[model samples]
Target: MSAGFSMHIFFTRFPLESQFGGAEVQTLSLMEGLKERGHHVAFLGSCPVLLEKCFALSVPYFDLNIGPPPVTKWHAISFLWRQFLMRKKLINAINEQPVTRNEQRVIFMLSLSEKLLLTTWAAQNKIPVFWIEHDSIGRWLRWNPWLPKLRRLSRLATTVAVSDMSKRMYLDLGWNPENTVVIPNGIDLRKFYKRQKILRSTTFHIGCVARLSPEKGVDILIKAVKNIPNIHLTIVGTGRDENCIRKLLEQSTLETHSNDEGQVYHLSPTTSVTILPSVPDIVSFYHSLDLFILPSRDHDPCPLAPIEAMACGIPTIMTDACGTAQYVENGKEAIVVPAGNTEVLHEAIKQTTLRTYEAASVQNTFSFERMIDRYELLFAHSAKL
Candidate 1:
């Protein structure tokens, strides 16, 4: 059966236009596919530009909240305080605002307050709410006070994790296994998998599309690149670790040109390393890459970049920290390495580059359509009251 159910889906906060990450892009793509399949979908969140883009795809949305202003501090303290306040205010704001009873609202949340509001509202009103689990599992467990509330509401709603790792996380926390489903992120095949004339370049354009955070393990990738000569690395996405990454990149460059590795490690960057900001031309981004690397130090539930890269016909090198790595074969679709190990990461990159894997073989099992189809089935089955 197609996604033709007569239902309305309300996603709480969709990062419709933020070029910084993949969650919003996946959400927008899913909404578009759902609309095409005859489901009525709408969103309530910040990112007006992204919201409008989704609307243009015939997925109507309402911007009901605004994100907190960007700040400079990258420490855990900054994240905790800001996230705490943001969630608190958002809960108060959304709670005060009235929503219609007829709407089948699925509150999208990046913070505790949003989760609380949606969970509470869904339980109180008997709405069939679904939590689209994003971010790391550790982050969810970090907030001690909310654990009881989550457990209490666990029976009231169905939770959908983007990856198997995320599903395991909920189960590990004693969440109802019957109430949880694993629906991975998808890609727009028509756009990202289009036929394009290939351009040949000497410098292997190895691309990484992720936030420049320490947890992302970009430094590991850089170290690997230094070991492998004559390749340029392109990092996409912005975050708190920009300065640290720049310094690391400079040191790697110095190491690359220097005779000694130790001497190459000490030099600092005079200018910020030129990192290309997030872009809308994801099709081009994927098309231009020889390899896509996800070097995350923490276990990322289901990262879209690797999947998207495969869809775009580019081979990938992913770490075991990525939950989606389980979906891939070691020597087939993509290579998986230990998290934070530069040696393994470097070897994986070298091997993939040397013996280029067939793009069709890598993409055959992991299409965006397949991922969406799984979600459609899960949603239909779980929507039962």
Candidate 2:
């Protein structure tokens, strides 16, 4: 399905993050594809990292500068006042450069607050609200209850989930089945293609790209790595658990060494682990890995890193609990294992041989073009309503 008419799409995020994740990557991809297709697209965001990204891509964006989340009752009132001011500013910003009457307007948001806050204004202007939810249920966001009911009362025109597993989770959380739909996170295969490994390291190499948060299970992966006798593990990305991961490394019998590739810690003569906060060239990281793994213990709604690795024809291992599990077949695209199982993870890591994967099939299945097409259809339908 495709939108026959051009749209003026406004993408949004609330409680924005400093470190980029799959959602940010997917948003940029959608914006790029839509811009290429001649749609007028803009980002309404506060995050510095994302705003700079929009600037680099030459995509227009409006910054509704944000403040910290409230930690107390009085702070909550202050936060609400700040949001009120932001909403007023947001309204004025949109009014200044309004879309042409012919192009349909769509507010594509990533949070429930966007819908609840903008409902009356959106309805008055004939702009349909589309919630593209990325987080799974039972995350830190669900700490409260009364606000969820309010969000339901202000139910959006459409809700887009990143995977079937994600869709199901929201369905249980009282999302309208008629309005909810699934769109798997997509990748640009040209950027993440397979390459021949020219240089080789003697040790078996395993790599994982994830935020070092509790839900991501980086600690579990570390425990599994400790058991493996002969291995080299590279953990990429940064989050709250950096110091904890370092401590885990130090507490173990691993020997630390300073290197050009950042810090390298050796568990033994046959085992070494390198932890890099960020990689300058990500495609090179994928190409360098012998095996890629996403050991998410609780929930992950269709992450793009493993898909990028699969696009590079690397054998993958991911837990069954995450939304990314639905995309790959067992022993084919990736090795699907039970979540948080150290022994199983250790056993899976033991099989160091790469599998025969058809990267072309992965490219065809999860291309950003197809993802945009699905979104176009969804937006087109909302416009018709």
Candidate 3:
């Protein structure tokens, strides 16, 4: 096994044709990094968009037409039947290239069933398999009846967690700690660079890029900014709670105006809350903000938003629930607050607005080169086994 070994990366839920998120970006960047390091990298998935992107990058890719998982009983049965067909397609794709024993490896980020199927195939063929866990342990691993079988299959593969928190969760869920590796997600510094800090505007612009969902705590952000003067919040991305969040904002505005008691609230007419659907110009979105916030209520495994903001030279306020908070100092790189505490978040926002921080202090820690080097080490080690 060497640094130039061939790697086959597999992801079942790659949403290439639709809106891509942090996970997609991380995966693509990793592939590019490996390619740049002179390794032969190939992607195997069902996403047409992914295939298209791979083609554009001149990377080898195979499409298995593995659409979204089945939701109904009838569809589940059909999916099982199609699974057999997909297995054949996958085998043929892998067999297309014959390499030395230590020159081939499989990297998978897949659903439980797909993982089990592929790992079994890999093991039978004496190929090393690595599983990257992008999420914390959840009911899927705890309550599923396939746990015993999945655990057995997992023993034959190396598991890579995205963060230390995620690794701990897997260990708590009975995954073998020795076989699990923690690899933090990295950002492409070239795509997100620090811009010249602009002078303060008449109204401060606080922006967030996240799905409008309960777990993301966008409502908490809205509530925190309600009475704050001259601070406008821009929320980007759409989700199931879009309508609900809009209604909450509208009602809050109505209530505030009605209770003004003939006194001006100090909130400027243009100082408003804006919700945007997903946009392609995310780098521009980060560059337009005076500050960025990630008010997650749930334990986000490893959020890329704050890191991206840091790279853009925008100070960020992220809740303690974000795993990336480990890399940030309270008053240095970012303002870390307790999750779900609106009052604390409000105060943190006010405090951060009074100060400026250096993005270079934290940007180097999450560079794509460092992340790639670590992955290369892990892959090379796995290949030797």
- Highest lDDT: give the candidate number: 2
Q: Which lDDT values do the candidates have, in the order given?
A: 0.66, 0.77, 0.72
In candidate 2 the C-alpha lDDT for residue 332 amounts to 69
Give per-residue CA lDDT, model 2, range 1-385, as digits (tens). 1466888888876553566777778888888998887799998867676788999999998887545434334544565567687667667766776789788887787654455556668877778877787765663344543347534743656778888888887777777898888888788877877878566677668899998888888888888878677788999988988899888888875478888988788877778888898898998888887888899998788888888888888888889877877777777667889998989998888874765465444665688888888888786677668
Which TM-score value belongs to model 3? 0.84
Q: Which is the better candidate, 1 or 3, if ranked by lDDT?
A: 3
Model 3's lDDT to the true fold? 0.72
Please identify which of the two predictions, 2 or 3, would achieve the higher lDDT against the true structure: 2
The digit string of per-residue lDDT tens for model 1 on 273-346 reads 23566656877877877788989998787788887787766778889988788877777777889999988787
Q: Which stretches of candidate 2 lie over 4 Å from their true place?
A: 66-83, 150-154, 197-200, 359-361
Candidate 1 achieves a global lDDT of 0.66
Residue 282 displacement in candidate 3 (angstroms): 3.1
What global local distance difference test value does model 2 have? 0.77
Candidate 1's TM-score: 0.78
Q: Model 3 Cα displacement at 19 (Å)?
A: 3.6
